[model samples]
Target: MSETTTAESAERRVRRRQSRRELIVLAAVEVFREMGLEKATLEAVGERVGLSKASLYYYVRSKEELLGHVVVHVVRAQEEALARVLDAGGPEERLRAFCHSHVRIICTDPVGRVSAQVALSGIRDDVVRRPLHEYMSRLESILRDGVAAGVFRDMDLRIAQHSIIATLNAVPLWFSPEGRLSLDEVAAQVSGLLVDGMLAKR
Candidate 1:
């Protein structure tokens, strides 16, 4: 075959491999979410995707590597979603948007629930901590900008940033799909409360 055709064929194979890995990662997410990560195993993850343990190795090198992929998929999505709101909005708007996005994801999305409850704890500490640290930094930047703009009360950003995230992270612990408040209600009320708390004195 010509070089160009050979390259095209190789590209197709890479895409197929990536697609397969993605499916495996998604399956691993479900298994990890259900089994508390420790009880979950490579054999189980493979079973979920109809791959033998050996077959799984064709896509992911190890359980740690697979978990790393899962973290990337989930966190990158969250960072992208929150960044869009915070990067462009005014202080109040961005804070409100950030709260809404955070609550919606953690309480409602499947991988998001995994992210809040169990996704980042045990595997690839550096891989997990760096993205989360950067995300927290972005939050601090927006909050500081708001304080400077007189949109938010002058307060310790360290306290404020952790308070906002930790508060939202607690939601999935008790939030239920069958609860009296719908997901929309929870997002609205909680985000409103968070935003209101940060508003500058009139």
Candidate 2:
């Protein structure tokens, strides 16, 4: 085969593999969300996708491995979203933008919320913990930068970071699309509160 043909074939193969992986992940998400992480089983997940237990094992070795896949997806998505906000004009804008996106994801991405909750206890190794730490550390750094730039008040950076993430993570508990407040409206309100509260006083 020609080089161009080989390249095209490789691209197609990768796309096919990604599609299959997404199917499995989606099934896992639905099962895990309905059953909760502690109760999520490979058999149930496989049944959700109409795959046999053995078949599911081919894709994922264990519950922890499946959790890792889900966590990676959530971490990467949030990272990409936050990266955009980091590039915004100023510290205030960046922080507000990050809050807006964070809230949006919490409301819409069930797996993302589960990933955060499960990461606390689901994974037991330093290898998994390190990436999770880095992801959160980035968010804390953003808050610290805002404070240093006189956009946010001089407060305990770790406390501020915890408050921000805690607020965002709570959305899955009370958020309802059919509720009075829309996601955008909720995000705006949350962002406003955080920004106004953190603004440096003249």
Candidate 3:
């Protein structure tokens, strides 16, 4: 085969492999959510995906690594969404969008729900901490911008940031697609509660 054709074939193979890996990760998320992280095993995840335990090892080295992959995938999506909001809007708009996006993320995806439900202790410290810190930093920057713009009241940045995140992170624990509130309703409620609380009283 010509070199170009060979490269195209190799790319197709790589894409197929990545697609398989993503399926494995999705199955792992379901297993992790159904069985708590402590109780979740590679064998259980493999069974969910119809792979033997040994075959599953081809995709992920260990349960911890799988957890890291799941967390990273979820966080990376949030980061990308946050970046778009950050780039286009003023502080107050950005803050509202951020809150709304977060709620949507947690409520809309099984993997995202798994992220909130599962403990991150299984993942390497830096792997878990770095994305969290970066996301929090983005949040703090928006808060600070609002304060500077006199749109938000002066307050402890750390407390405000943590409070907003803590509240949003708790959504997966209680939110239900079958519940009375829809995803957009919950997002609006959450954004209003947190964002309105920060607004400077007229």
Candidate 4:
């Protein structure tokens, strides 16, 4: 009984620690996004989460580390969102879902906004760069599948993928949640244009 209780206590501690780390990461994302990474400070992030500078250190080692965590988190989210569409949708449907995913990532998610805003191509860490590479590959896989299925055009898949991503990434530059056009409206419009352009001729 004591062993079981001890194990449960340890598990709770781990869960709490993980929960706190995630909260701090979220706070860090907001700080970095608002202030831009080079200008963002640990003190600001800690204040957002109600933690002191010293206490924030317990959760994250540095601003760079927080950015890394945000990168990994953002990419993982993008992959998982696409994975769900890839699993059960047809080419057209999957492409539409991808549009929604793209919009949500850039416009709705704070971490994702930061990821898109930052010059991630400058990041050299393999751990950070690895997921981004996989993300690009997944995007190409979607394009390739669409082409093979006779849904997408026969043009260079790389160009198509890059164009789609570049257009979507530009959303946050001018997108406003408080604007007249809602997020869904933007996604639908983009998805229609991109997907319809790729449709196989009747």
- Please give, for residues 16-94, the per-residue lDDT of candidate 3 as tens digits: 8889999999989888878877889999989988999788888887877777677677778788888786778788899
Instruction: Determine which window of 10 residues in candidate 4 has minimal summed lDDT.
Output: 118-127
The clash number for model 2 is 0
| Candidates 2 and 4 compared by lDDT, better number | 4
How do the residues 2-110 of candidate 1 rate in per-residue lDDT, one tens digit apiece?
Answer: 9999999999999999999888978888997888767888989899999987888898876667666765676677777876766677988888887778778777667
Question: Which of 2 and 3 is the better model by lDDT?
Answer: 3
Tens digits of per-residue lDDT, candidate 2, 1-202, equal: 9999999999998898777777888788888889887888999988888889887787777877777777777778877887766676787887788788877775678777777666545458654465666767877777788787877789988888777777776766777889899889988998898878878898
Candidate lDDT (C-alpha), each: 0.78, 0.78, 0.82, 0.79
Between candidates 1 and 3, the one scoring higher on TM-score is 1
**Could you give the C-alpha RMSD of every candidate to the true structure, in order shown?**
2.7, 3.1, 3.0, 3.3
Error (Å) of candidate 1 at residue 3 is: 2.3
Q: What ranges in model 1 sit over 4 Å off?
A: 79-88, 119-124
Steric clash pairs (candidate 1): none
Quote each prediction's TM-score.
Answer: 0.83, 0.79, 0.80, 0.76
Q: 1 or 4, which is superior by TM-score? A: 1
Candidate 4 lDDT score at position 148:
93
Index of the highest-TM-score prediction: 1
Residue-level error in angstroms, candidate 1, position 114? 0.7
Better of 1 and 3 by lDDT: 3
Predicted model with the maximum lDDT: 3
